[model samples]
Target: MVHLSHKFSTIPINFIPKQFSKHLPQQIPSQTTPPFIPFSQRQNQRSLLESQLISALNCCTSLTQIQQIHARILRKGFEQCCYVLTKLIRILTKMEIPMDSYAKLVFNQVENPNPFLCTALIRGYCLQGHVKESVFVYSEMRKKNVLPISFTFSALFKACGVVNDVDLGRQIHGQTILIGGFGFGFDLFVKNSLIEMYVKLGFLGCGRKVFDELPGRDLISWTELIVGYVKAGDMESAGELFSELPKKDMVAWTAMVTGYAQNAKPREALEFFERMLNEGVETDKVTLVGVISACAQLGAAKYVNWIRDTVENLGFSPTRCVVVGSALIHMYSKCGSVEDAYKAFKVMEEKNVFSYSSMIAGFAMHGYAYAALELFHEMVKIGIKPNKVTFIGVLTACSHSRMVEQGRQIFESMEEKFGISPGVDHYSCMVDLLGRAGCLEEALNLAETMPLEPNGGVWGALLGACRTYSNPDIAQIAANHLFELEPNAIGNYILLSNIYASAGQWNDVLMVRKMMRERGLRKNPGCSWLETKKGVIQEFFSGDMSHPRYGEMKQVLEDLLNRLKAIGYQPNMNSIAYDVSDEEERRILITHSEKLALAFGLLDINADFPIRIMKNIRMCEDCHSFLCAVSQITRRVIIVRDNLRFHHFHDGKCSCGNFW
Candidate 1:
């Protein structure tokens, strides 16, 4: 299944990458006059043994068992026998047997290799993420007079795709045409693979041409074309083609759903799934994932519950089975239901590395950084190895807690013990960790030392820190870095402007906003959702009244402000970018996103219920402080999740210690 990474070898069967540990043997085809080996002959006994060994190799799942069989093959000096060599490769590839040592061992033993074995090795390298090695095997294959099969060429094209080498893929496409398989019956299969390769390489126009030229079509062919359209952001065409297909299978349905969900059209994917169900096609785990995701996007808690119940009733267990459980965790997290996510995680039967990672993210999102950190330790104790995502989660926890030293230790340990090099994301998290802890100089130095170019989020993190510290010099550097990478990242520019404004560099702030006008960059509007007694209603920008309870909402806010201020509450209007009278500023701050949501919560909910607010952007410092004060004065629990981490407010204190 495409949903599970470890379950199946997604690498196409025919063009198995050269990195796979299977062996292929070459033997000259005998002419019709030649006599075959007799079953009763002494040499035939060796052939029988070889056949049994190949069967054993095919059945082996563990690398240890494969190695034992491989050692016997080497001991008997049958390593050069193509038949045995090929089965060994199958075991290694299907089982995700590690690369390097075994791959080299297989390569050294193959003598006068079969075209199939050479091609398998070539493709295995790409699948195993050794693109350069796959290319080297192909070059060697050419030298050995191993005429390429269409599958061999397909593997080569895939290698080019892996390395983002479009020019190399084009060269191979020309070779495939010259080799005379361009118009054959299996042409669609080969060509679809080529076109998909180009899509992966980001040459959608070229990929489209290849797709237009294919002579026959299958589900794979249609999937490749649909994926090409989705990659190019032409989901309309992809959707059109998806609708017109006479025969629809799980792969095709999942492909379309994945495309839509990835492109932020989760609702459309859910609708597509409904049409699929109407056609009598029961949803698989893959489709269920997309369905839950779409519901999450809509924030339909009831709809998600229905899907969960159905999944259970259909005999589909939720655990580490595939990606369904992980998706559910994410869905609940995004919908601000961490309790439900925890319930799901607690009952899971088999937990893999990703299982803990998703739960950690859930806790982190809910402002339970302590829980997130504890889970990280639990992951290590249980021998569930950490990956880049696990470290990112830990770093996020440190950032949330303002634990600079803990972040440093984990960052260094990534290189020292794990031997996993920090990618740009890891580096970005470090900067966030340090920046949040008020170590501006160290964070800036780390950003400069990043092995890869820093993306927008890194500079944005630094800029935000500058805003907190009221630093102008480093803020300018972050602004320049951000503008260079993505000139239209409006958030970075606004943050830099805020930093300048906070530093009393009003002229510089004016200049920045002026430049924003010239570039047509507008600040993204803020939005908030308030769950009323009737239903959930949304308000945004400047006190949106699209809700059914508009008049009641206005009166509720008025009452809350009066009652809260009587209890020692005060408005902090420091986030206002423009000049205004003290009273006007205070009045405007009350209408801000979080306050508006809190007002709605005060009037609708039972006195004991907590007020939960989610913001599309980061919570302003003034709002964060105001929330703390509001919680204490009103004796209410206020939970807020902004562009960064969550904040739980109670008794004039925030869970983040007012750091975030």
Candidate 2:
């Protein structure tokens, strides 16, 4: 309301300072000549105009509206005002308007820009991902002798982070020291941003040194180094810094939660979430996502339900939250509730690549190949393109079900139809699909000749299939490559030995065992886990009878084994990786981890509820047969999730059809 234009009317034309006359516009002859505005009054008028322009820009939601305001700026003869022009530049950047278009034109109109204006333009280019152009602007600012602002160096550092250009970042770093001097007001900001750039570029030691050398540090400085350590998977260092943070915020808490989840320490992630809650830290969607993911990894239904209710209490619903829904789908499926996973997927209001892929992978993991294929088609029909992970799910479904033709078609269409070239993981899936279908030679050929060099997964897939189909010769080829690719992977050696034993080739099995001894590698003990009705996870190790109820568990297993033998099931001597006498092999087979888990589940789990068991390694032949018989005799549905896939046994049949 107190506009400069109204106040100027009360002042006389002759009252203008003589020294200020030249800065104002010249009077015209024909028009009733307006009074000459003094330089101080003009400055006030320009500030008022800029304030009004900022208010107007804030309300502009679209490019067209902002453009109209830009025309007003030009009409008011305020085009050269750096205060107004800098705001204009940033608004355009926020609107995602290209820097080359109206922004550059507006910036070019300012004859001499101050540091603020120059930095704003630099940030505009940086925000648009035009790092080269932003550097060019920095150079021009230097040529014009404009003192760079703290934000100018911040923008340049940010640009370097975007392009991952450490060399350019160092050049800017040198310039900061040369111009701003060490420990200057602007220098701290520049140093902080430099630390961030180095951390983001995967130089943790450099970031640490920068932090250590800083005379004073802020939360942001500490957080930058902490995140750097977290990204490097050095959670120990991250935790130490986090413990030292005086006042932690939501961002820092979320970082720890997500970091623990990403590094496969789900229990630690859950513990952090609880601690954060006790500290009265407000949780956001990001924090909730990390917690949800940890629950998914735990594969516990109680944890899943708690997180779901907690999310709803926090005003987030899986139906409306795509990220939450995707995480819930993954959790439910891993918990042996694929039906719940599908329900979540169906209720989601929005489905992104992650949502569809999670659902597809859930179906594939549960051996519902047709459902996975149907979801893929639906995703395509809805114009949601399949990403690399999506194709992995599709191919995995086909592999589990032995749908060779469908698998081949999907693999071929990856490049031609989806425009995503097959990655190494895709090739691995193809090998798995062909190998699991008893096409050992074809799978081996594809793995050996793929464009990308086969990683451990590719060879591992072939070797696993060799175990299933009893192909010792091809297993050797795969094992040799795996030995070179992953020399320390004891599973590969164990798989090769098992394959040889399956073929009744004891000498080759001895060779594999001898090689393992030579390399100082020992087989990992077979382990299994089953969640109790009370939500306690019970872990079992092969031949470890240390449980409180070990006597009862042994009796249960012996009774079941005797029944299995009476029903014509025999001990698979090859299942024992060691060359031992027949009696020892039978004893070892009965004491396998999964069988122990199965016996415990039968004794403790409710008859109505299906028994869910998780194994760290592949199920052996004798255990698989024994479980099938157990399922028929007890009239129970048994769900066993091994390292590779799920096996659903019901009424003397397995979902994998005795193929896996």
Candidate 3:
């Protein structure tokens, strides 16, 4: 084997001058061949051998085959061939062979490793989660004065992100500027890698700084910082960056859409998607999922149908695309159409844990405990392991249906059978289950003794249960903890106040209100949205008689109240926490946002379509009973989606069976 001397090592690592190739010894031809072979023929034979070795390495699937090839290379006296060795190390990395176990040994045997060879090893170690080992290799390369390529820094930056070692990343960053000078420092690929690393490490400000300092930037650089801001929940900054981008691609558009959906600004997400389509940008499964999520949040049937059509037109079939199908199931479920969710689930060609969990949760949200339980078992029977979300859905089903014993059995089996340790959410579901079933004392004990600290959801559930059974004492206990845990949550104060009102403890209710005043916390106004037959969404607020059709809506409500009174139905005066007259209480109940939406639905929505209304807060007891009577008297189906769950009213009955 021949080796290059250190005297000529000052040349760039990537370039080996032609003058050096002429001095290398040539492989001897076989004895059967002519000993006087021409120089060009010997060169051709060597070139053919190198090509054949590369092709063989490409086809090598196992380590044994690679070892056999390595032996053949040594026998042919190509041990110092950097090109073939580089390819070999890459293949080993692709096969996920550990760096220290095999590839490092191959690297150690090389007498003069070039830039590519060193980079391949560095990348391999980084990929294998050996960041320190990769850095050590880089240090050795520097000691030998082998300059690194752009990919070397990229690989190191990505590894630092994987291990969350920002300090090491900064050191590598400094080396890029020092060793390679500003030319390499300003390399587009390296800059993008730095931005990605900082973004992934939650240093969005650092990523933005890099972006702002780039002398020349591409769409990739712009999009990296945009995505970084989106991940940090800074949609304002993301939008500003996007506005300044001269060339917008599908990835950038998708980032904004997904960011809005995740941040609960669903309307903005839909609007951005619409603009993306109008600008002639293409949509993919990811973009469609974001749009579907936004539509689900709106919970309007008109938007639901529009998104369904858009999904089909874009060639994303729910039956074929698993992610799109799973998203559709969730969207339909959230839009108050569990039947449609099941339909989408039924047509899917493949089912994973997400699809099953969405279906079970849909059934649970609609109070179909038996259906949720059945699907849960079916998913388990088909070898799909239920995750934490799946158990939450199951326990929620038990809570809604008051299946206390079944819920207890499932909760106990979570860790013992499925190896899924219950999280805080699962504990909250258990508390809600026991609390909803009139076991307030037991639920309180569980919340106090649970391994994890009780969050707002746990105490909130207990307080809600107290309202259900008119237990102000337990409600006070839950509210006290909630006040400390969530000082500014207006819902907690309201829930506690409602419990006091239900128990005729007006003084306690006044005290809660006083505390809210002191904290400058105002109750969120009751708001509802109803879609007209023309697909226009109308908004209504409690005690706000400002709609253009307020006259007709008032007349409709008056007529309904008169009919309800004829049937011996009386107004639930306790629904109002204020110490007002009977007439004032009746007026306030009639002016509730949901009631107004119901009147608008009756006037504008066709009888063939069920009246669907979405509310921002939970429906009051007075409104729930009123809707049940209206559904029976008018012979109509009404669906109301509040903060917690869906209520389907038909023929004087609610799907919740009066338990919600």
Candidate 4:
């Protein structure tokens, strides 16, 4: 008898009708004398074999196992069964096997392929990022007079979204409208997939147009457009859609919360989270992460215990959820408790790259350089790959601590040892490290000669270093680049003017002021936030005594100034960037937002607890010195987080060792 395998390849299976005899063998072996089973028994045995083959395909965990099952299908003469073949194609896609290597071959062997079978192959190609191949497959299906299913369009649109092929997406989108039956068959799944595609491709207007045209919109459709608005930085549009959404689910609620958190609107995030809770929407790990991230940005100690408790109450342990643990580590660190951040890091049963990076970043941000480096070494020992973010944390630790040599070695070893090429961010860290170490010339050299095109961060780092060392010449060069790169960034102009003023270059300072005026740029008023013992947040702006306790705060500031002056703390007159009298400069320096926050903190914060202040701008030299003296005089630890890094003052010294 002819080999059974060869016979199976030519047999007409379930998908192929008997009239489609071109794929069938020309002759069949007849068994006249053999004792044969009944026709019902033979059919039953074939069905049983088909069921067993499908079950085996489902249980297959490896490519080799799948190949064995495919061989078994051929032996059973069921290779062309559309149902079984579709399942095989889906399994191959799930296993991430390349469609070209196996699925395509299986599809080509089938005769009179069904719509579902063709769509499965198209979906397989789409899953493997072969969009062109999927489109080709669609064309072939159309040529074969096979009507595409709903999932076919969904898969194609999703592929378009993945590759950001908006042009092809538009083509497919147009087909959905032009093709009569297919357009009517375009259900919620296809519509939502189209919305997601347009949104992800940065075509929010198109996405909205699709949303408006949909006969009925679901939660996914609304959420996709809302998230698109948020990503485009148009929160107002996002809010309008969000308000218009009738039935909200947890995913929709989480999108709003996450949008606010990502846009740096922490208060709005918390408010949305509260609203989500009040509406009785269920909370998941994603929702909690959004809330936790907002709390981290706030850096308020009062929210720390509450958020931690909420996470535990929801049965999402920081120790169990690495994301929660990472967010907690960041929260505690920003809240001025590096110890608590470490505790969270220690209890994490499963530590990934994120956990290690967050903990190290927390240590670095808190100026715990030794701790950051130790953790980094431990991460390497445990074989977790150090990504760009991890290296950023390591370099930040070195920069803040003035570990110039150590930082340099690591910077050099980035591409060579760790296989992580230094990005613009890493170069920014180097500029900061060298600049902080008083290596102005070297930092400037590195900034000018680096392989990558420097971004705002690189120029900003150089400008910051210039401010630290009072190098007006280098600051001007950095400022010129910054002015072109970030014309509207008032901080860059302010920093440049400050550097010039520090060197008593009044003419240059006036020129900077003129440029600011010509560009219609106004100085960003410095603001500081302080959380009181009663958990009420108070804000202080430079030279603004608008607080309800302004009178008491003024008196407190005056007393502290007197006490600070008595201890030989003279105001650094150069801190004022304006061309003014020395005495007037002293008057202006004392009214800075940080000083105002410090006074209010001393007044309201309890004696046992450390005072925490958050500032919108970097503290001036005079304020830094003033806080050091105040910390020594009051015998209290003061933690101040500025625009850049944290300053922990205790007994007349800062945790940064005065390098920052």
| lDDT of all predictions | 0.74, 0.85, 0.88, 0.85
Identify the superior model by TM-score, candidate 1 or candidate 2. Answer: 2
**Where in model 4 is the C-alpha error above 4 Å?**
1-49, 75-82, 108-118, 139-146, 184-186, 412-418, 440-452, 562-588, 658-660
lDDT string, candidate 4, 82-130, tens digits: 9888989999999999998888888888877898999999998998899
Worst 10 residues of 2 by lDDT: 1-10
The regions of model 3 sitting more than 4 angstroms off are: 1-93, 96-148, 159-182, 232-236, 265-267, 383-391, 408-423, 439-459, 469-486, 500-511, 558-590, 620-622, 625-635, 651-653, 657-660
User: Which lDDT value does model 1 have at 551?
Assistant: 69
Q: TM-scores for all candidates?
A: 0.80, 0.81, 0.80, 0.86
| Model 4: pairs clashing at backbone N, Cα or C within 3 Å | none
TM-score ranking, high to low: 4, 2, 1, 3
Q: How close to the true structure is residue 593 of candidate 1, measured as C-alpha lDDT? A: 74
Q: TM-score for model 4? A: 0.86
- As for candidate 2, its clashing pairs are none
Model 1 Cα lDDT, one tens digit per residue, 1-660: 121122222323333223323442223235568676676784776776687578657756677566656655664557688777867775677676655556556765566888778777777777888877877887787788777777787778777887888887887787677666435224766787787898888787787677667665677777877877887778898888888777888777877876787776766887777777677776687777877777666554555776677667666778645478877887788777889898888888888877789888888766677898899889888788888898888888778778778778888998897888898888888888888888999999989988788888788788878887878999999889889998987777767777787778889988888888889886566776545555444555544555565567677767766876787766545466445698777766766777777877887877787776767687776688778877887799887777676678998898877666
Count the clashes in each prediction: 15, 0, 0, 0
lDDT of 2 at 54: 75
Distance from true location, Cα of 508 in model 1, Å = 1.1
Model 3 is weakest, by summed lDDT over 10 consecutive residues, at: 1-10
- Winner on TM-score (1 vs 4): 4
lDDT of 4: 0.85
